[model samples]
Target: MRWGTFTSSNSVLLLIDHQVGTMKLIQNIPFETAKRNTLALTKAAKILGMPIILTTGTENGFQGPLLPEFKELVPEAYDARIARSGVVNTWEDPEFRAAVEKTQRSHLIMAGVTTDVCLYSPALSAVEDGYPVQAVLDASGSPTELSEQLARQRMERGGVTLTATNTLIAELARDWSRPEGSELLKLMVDDVLPPVF
Candidate 1:
């Protein structure tokens, strides 16, 4: 299927476990890259006017709160700190599930700190619920390259389409003629696309 089939209005962006808590153990994808993609996602979501749902697990003392940058990105999003423990799978969070439902969008755009535990779980759950899920794989981190591959494979099997942050931004832009076009192009150049052109 075409990757950009889900437009901004029909999509819901879910940022799972982007907390300073989960940021500590990330390994495979360099922390800087993950941070950039996460930040890019937040910025794109805000620009596209997509519904933003943010969730954190054990943000109180066990790990840490969501990064200040992300919180600053979408100060109006429904931010919730779920009380459940054990499991990077955020679909189990009541608040997360409710927020997803509230968005009322059938297409889900997802990314998380850990590829397997954080990104994979919610992708699978959404697939089972008959929703089209697009996972930003590179934006999601893992403990190792091995785990990252496995996480991506599992989600693919479950029908989650994988994409990178740049591909997604370009797809959404569709053309550099929209009102937000130039600004988005600048964003891709500054964040996703390198200075190769």
Candidate 2:
């Protein structure tokens, strides 16, 4: 399958370990920018009617909960957000696996905090499991710029597609004529597009 062709029905959005603590530790991109991009991805996923699975390594301990802004974008009933205490790789967590299974999607759209750990682990695992996985680079973070770049290279080498959040939104939208296109445009305005002069 062409990596660019992603139908909402055939794709699932996986947000892993986007907890407050980890988000704050990201130095490669500004925390607010990462948050904005992540919010864009979540809002786009919701507007496109895609199944969403949100996971965190640990809530009460060091990781903290998912960003409040991110949580607010995802409706509780429409998406599944799981908190696992000890799993470094969300794919290794049974609940996360079950939620992915429930989506029944062949293509996985993913991004996460601390790219090397939270993002790389599951993305490569899913690819090994025969799922076409795409990682939204701008929406993910790492402790250092080098680490982030290396993680992306590792995933690309492992057959995972690397793309930006806007690209994913465009791919999912497919055309600007659709009603959802306007919604996606609004999201881009809030999170990505340059301000009007």
Highest TM-score scorer:
2
lDDT of 2: 0.85
TM-scores of all models? 0.91, 0.94
For residue 119, give model 1's deviation from the true position in Å. 1.3
Q: Per-residue alpha-carbon lDDT of model 1 for 56-170, expressed as tens digits?
A: 7776764578878865677777344344465567886766788788888988999887786878988999888888899997678888889888988898988899999988887
Judged by whole-model lDDT over C-alpha atoms, candidate 1 comes out at 0.80
The number of the candidate with the highest lDDT is 2
Model 2 TM-score (2 dp):
0.94
Give a tens-digit lDDT track for model 2, residues 1-197.
45557778799999888888889889998888888888888889889988888887778877787888765677672245787888888888998898889877888999989897789989999999988999998899899989998999999999999989888888888777879988888788777765797
Question: Which sections of candidate 2 miss by over 4 Å?
Answer: 1-4, 77-79
RMSD of 1: 2.1
Backbone clash pairs for candidate 1 read none
Q: Tell me the deviation in Å of residue 173 in model 2.
A: 0.6
